[model samples]
Target: TLLEGVEEKIEDITNKLYVVLAALIKGNRANCSNFAQSARLNWLVNRLQSQQASSGALEVLHSVLVDSPEVLNMITEAHILAIIGLLDRNGRDPKVLDVLCSLCVNNGVAVRANQNLICENILQRRDLLLQTALVDHVTW
Candidate 1:
């Protein structure tokens, strides 16, 4: 069984397993330091940085980012802020944006603070303002 195989490979599964275990135990209140110190996080970021060369890698990362609670918790507030800032400046993929918004909501983080700023930025782009207003009002 997969559980038995995983048990056999326990030592080789990587620190992400421990980080995930901690998050599962503590939920949204999980300590951020474990994520910050994780080698697995570094590996994930490196993999994302190189994703342009391989679309399959991007899909894998999108899956991890969207589906893994541990991976979601591993995202620091600084990283979230940066991504929101980038979305404000350059727009964003709707699917990815939805995933991010959902993650923020699920993690019990206040998405309103930066989400408002991003909406305002989008509004500055002419006809998009109305759409932004509608989304903001609904989400709020």
Candidate 2:
């Protein structure tokens, strides 16, 4: 089962499972996109809501979002919003927030991201504040 490996109590095994899943999603983005947009993706996202196994699920999600922008289109706005909400809840992991911020570069995000406080977080990065602000504004 897809959840079996991820549900392992062993940390190394769980990380390895995430690596394999991320590689699979990257290797065949089209098929993965089909899967990512299905109910299965919802199940995977629910994994992120869990406290123990969320990091592995988050790693897979971050990899997919970074490696396959088209998959983002396959994901619904509500799911994306949920991811952003997760970012706020799990703000300790900067990579997750970075992935969410990267989505701001996508089209139609201005509307979907209205409720997300992406700007406040971006402002915290002095190096990216100006560049991101300009880019986000221009892209909008």
> In TM-score terms, which candidate is top?
2
Per-model TM values vs. the true structure: 0.37, 0.55
Task: Give the range where candidate 1 is weakest over 10 consecutive residues by summed lDDT.
Answer: 50-59
lDDT of 1 by residue, 53-110 (tens): 2223223334444444466656655444444443444355453465356545544656
> What TM-score does structure 1 among the candidates reach?
0.37
Candidate 2, position 73, lDDT: 59
List model 2 lDDT by residue over 1-140, tens digit each: 76777566566676678777777776466745655556776777666665454666776776666565665555666666566556556654675665575566544454255234455544554343233333445443
The root-mean-square deviation over C-alpha atoms between each candidate and the true structure, in angstroms, is 12.0, 9.8
**How many clashes show up per model?**
0, 0
Q: Give the runs in model 1 whose Cα sits over 4 Å from its true position.
A: 1-37, 43-59, 105-140
